[model samples]
Target: LAEKSNSVVDNDSKRKIKDKGCIPGLPIDGLPVYTGKEVAEHQDPDKSVWIIFKAGVYDVTDFIQIHPGGRELLLGAGNSVEPFWKVYSQHHNQQVYRILESYRIGNLREEDRLKEDRTQDEMESLEFIPERDPLLLVHHEKPFNAETPANLLIQNYHTPNNIFFVRNHLSVPKVEEEDYSLEIEGIGLDRTYEFTLEEIKTLFPKHTVTSVIQCGGNRRNDLNKVEMVKGISWQLGAIGNTRWTGARLVDVLRYCNADLEHPEIKHVQFEGLDLDAKSEPYGASVSSVKAFDPLAEFLLAYEMNDEELPADHGYPIRLIAPGIVGARNVKWLAKIILADHESQSHWQQNDYKSFPSNKKQASPEEFAQAHAIQEMPIQSAICLPEDDQIVQIKWKRIDDQTKPFLDVAGYAWSGGGRSVIRVDVSIDGGKTWFDTELEQETPTKRSTTTFSWTLWKSEIPLDFNQLRNTGNQIEVICRAIDSSYNMQPARNEEIWNFRGLLNNSWHRINIKVV
Candidate 1:
């Protein structure tokens, strides 16, 4: 017992064992909590093909192979299908939800339900689910969070409005364009100001800025491999680049006689129209260092990708704070507050801040001391030659020698408007590396103002003669360097955290060069 127990699940152990982890369901209302062990105990196909999803435990023995996907549906017989839903979004529709509800025998326990599959406790804040593209992998419904596919993510410089990644904290607010209003008040303002959508657009000159908005939790899945982190198992798709057309936030604040740099103002809070069960709207803030910086390029954006903003993306209006984490770019922006301190919302105070990896639980005092996440760290990912893919080789026969190779491509970016200067690609993993050509949508500009992402692609030459010496597989890797010379950490454990925010580790994927 002095040496070690049979096993442990601390961060160190989880790091050595990198596995795809799932967030267990939490009890809603006063429902019972059932562990995975209990769910597994009921997994006899002849009796009940039990399944766990979100927090629901279902018995589908009567349905059997009658499912539309046939045996494919049984693949998740004894486990949670949350992972499967990441790539298979077709089954996330109302019909599927209803069918699963009919078979529900109980709930998947976290602390954890249930006469009802979900109740007001779980969805009182939710309005209605909006229709999303089947290609966009869904992480949560109701609020409707989803991400783009890796391949499609880089196909366009400005992601299409339809397929753009969404990270809504609550249901899309119902606000008609004519009645939409933005209220401004708090410490720095001379007086409270309220303006309609028309006044906001007509009163100020419209400006456009091409920028990238990425969820702070974008690469959380990578962190989960090291140790299970709490949050959506979001992969690399929770990011998008686009042109935002709106009035400059600086101009609007000045008009209200409250410049962000005012002596009394230390932070700028943005609140959303969508609210929680307690009627507390989604809220976040940026310090004056960011809010007051001219290079910050904060905007009261009404248009996305040159079109009117979609409802799922805060239609009437939203805050587009370049170089900052997406959470601070509040959607369905309802109010702007110039305050002496940061926003006092749950998201601002407790959730978004990064914590030490070793601490499994945090005290309230620890959360209060942590600063809000503003700038993102330098990062990159490999989209082409997906993990475990059978890579097809290409070569020039000028010398009659079959020199095979693989083409790799992906995106890179850094926060605080730091442009991605270079992307290093590797064919034999980190043992070798080569720089790739980068393509930027916006005109080349200063590193501190270049808020968009850089798409990089390269043809990594393969060593045909030595291809089969080690094995039939090739490990594709990428690490980006920002203009500030900040490079992504080489290993996930180097920056592992409990919340899994800001995981900008070197993105690596293994593929077969058969």
Candidate 2:
């Protein structure tokens, strides 16, 4: 049989050999070299499904049925799998290689291989807009995270979209208006309800809420000074106030027949359309009580400050969990689940949690026991005269009196619907204090439901004699009192954590009195 197989083969024999498998010795190194166009033709799963990994092509039609991640996730079926594999790193292991080796058909053409390699590199490169405002201080460029300068934050009552602090975990996904849809599911519902962009607008009554969204690590830089901590060194600019217009989350849940009162529903998990390298969606969760409370003012916002939601700020839809940490306000919203447990996303379980101040080096067990930060504590920061800034003071000697004054300004806010009742400022570093005029743009001044931040300013009567004697350095300190009588701690050491989160200590800034 071996001798007979070695004989000169006819067209029928050659066809059989090719159909069964590769022959022992054949031209083109025992595998046919398919053109780039020919490889693209097999993209359809129903037909011949082919994918390229490295420089080799594989026919994965049979393997698609048994793919653990599902066949729909095989996005590179018609093209190179390098991009998908780069994100889903699990494929880079040896076990996956063994599985793929069985389906290997041929090597990709050299030109196509080089083109795909270049395309993969481009996809992995971090992308950011070059026209970003100069006022924004970039913390990271890959994910395009930045914060507004403290001085610019007080320029207006409502923060402009361009200068708003951006805290992104993944690339901003570009979603088409016509193709956008929101999915609702979980144990509290009988079935899933998919809502198109138009249906979301027409089916519910539009409601607007002027609220403040603050990152959990708003004043992390202050904490970092006391002790080195993990996370972006965000100053006081991580918070922003805006008017969000959309349907109430409670109304939407009820419209979808969600059993908000169901005993099994403890949390509402939100998934964003923005995907990570692993193809997993960015996600977070809020307590079911907060999500379902009509007074909580939660929103599925489509508009920001009367304008259509900008692409940087979640485009068509984003969740606004007022009075909660900004991380819970999931943007570019895609799916919502009424779950018994909190979201299993990395941001929910691992990050955004505060540990004990004494636990300098936290272990995995300690982090697991620590509760995630939801509602922030009393917080305030001086925005006008930034830290280490030199201010020019005007001194006048009129008649028989010498008078000097300085204008101080900043913002204060508290979580869980608490209003900042008063803000106290001291130029002598907490020795002497004076009250500042508090200004807020909320619906009711008496209402404790202060979802917006309070902007406070005061003109302090400075003692020229004392200022001249203080070696030209003045330490200014500010602390806030909430409606509940909660005040920021005197020092960061009191509230310091490994993650540098929720740093609401009395914000201090030293200025040179020039």
Candidate 3:
């Protein structure tokens, strides 16, 4: 044999090693030690697929089809798997190790092994600030998902970029303005178009839309109270209203000669710059009808609240699909694909879906049957006097006797371009309700759509002596009515779902009167 060679295998030497006789798991006199360059040559799945795991080479060509995470997520088919496996720690188990052992082919040369070790060390040293707002409650760190507290969310009509709720699916990508480019492609387009930051800014007239972007799972904690549901246990602050300024998506589509009238085009997929370990970008799709609709009020926003978009909010650009669920208003937008089908991304296909209340577990069949959440339902929440809080009420003379009166303030919103016309507040758990004064920021004349949220406040009168005699605690509930006359459901149990999406139930809070 080759005298137990420890040196790296060149292209010609690797071919020679492959020709030499060897058996699986058997002791060979001169087992091949492949160089990193040699390993990269087998990346194409149609030819051969190789991956290095802890200095061990494995031919995972057949295993690709059986990989639980799917074949596309195999991560660098012919490169070291250490960096990716570090991000996806699920593969660190003994079961996955044994499975990899079955596909062992050879070992990485000592020189390449050392290089991979150094690369992994560099990757481990990278740090990301997964959070920005101290008041926002964090749900996950790596993906950097957080929600604003109800009290802080209603402090202003336009939520500040710093404290705005963030719902990222991956680490916030660092994008430089000079290097940024927005791509437009796919089957529905006559030709593809690429625009730099400056080109996009000057190419079209800047349009502004004041709108609300709400998470599909807003108020999910209420649903969780009725029954355990899967999702970030967002209390009530997963929604925000902001003024977004950018070029119209329709105008951009026209500039690119997109075949919007094409009958085959069903969805417009948006891909973000943020990527996962597999290098797959975060993506979601909106209906082409909405994308092309002149009155839909969609925008490719470069500015939020008249300021440049913050890094956490798609610094260079983002899709602002007003009146739609926030998930469809994709951030860090880099590519717009006019496709015949919806985006096959995990967020579009599996998550942000509404399931039947009876569905206890998330299954393939349930996911397949459920439709992705688009527009939200009528929703409102009490921001001040938090649940289980003690409120010192001021005494007021009512019928010549002392009675407690306090101001209750909160926000109310609806989806599908509907405005919140009325918000009813009840201090006795829906037994009696009083209408609150609704205030909405004036919409831009260009935007005929009503997409912004309304801040509602009401001063409630309480009988102090009657409450003191019965109990100190009282339940306060609020429900909203949309312009379409649609009202929030009376209870969470009635509208609970497996994914905890669209929980537009009456918001209730219990406060101790002092």
**TM-score of every model?**
0.77, 0.76, 0.77
Expressed as tens digits, the lDDT of each residue in 376-495 for candidate 2 is: 888899997888889987666767887777788999989888889999999987889998998886556446586888999987778867878998788889999998999889999998
Off by over 4 Å in 2: 1-120, 125-131, 395-402, 444-447
**Model 1 segments beyond 4 Å from truth?**
1-126, 259-261, 397-402, 442-448
CA RMSD of all predictions: 11.8, 12.9, 10.1
| Per-residue lDDT of model 3, residues 1-514, tens digit only | 1221223445554443344323222222344668889888888777678888766777787766656445654566889776565444334433455566556667778888888888766764574453386877887665566888878888899998888888776678888898999999997676778999999899999999898988887888888777766566788888899999999999999888877899988999999998767688889998988888978889999999999998888879999998899988888899999899999887787678876788655555556566888887888999988998998887778688876787789999888888888999997768789989988966557763689999999989887675886587888899999889999889888998866789888888988877
Q: Total clashing residue pairs per candidate?
A: 4, 0, 0
What clash pairs does model 2 have?
none
Instruction: Kindly give the stretch of ten consecutive residues in candidate 2 with the minimal lDDT sum.
Output: 1-10
The Cα RMSD in angstroms, rounded to one decimal, for candidate 1 relative to the true structure is 11.8
Query: How accurate locally, in lDDT, is each candidate?
Result: 0.76, 0.79, 0.79
**Candidate 3 ranges beyond 4 A from true positions:** 1-124, 127-131, 397-402, 443-448
Q: What is the TM-score (0 to 1) of candidate 1?
A: 0.77
Clashing pairs in 3: none
Candidate 1 collision pairs: 32-112, 33-112, 34-109, 55-108
Give the per-residue lDDT of model 1 (tens digit) for 316-386. 89999998898888999999988888898878886788888787545666777877798888979888867
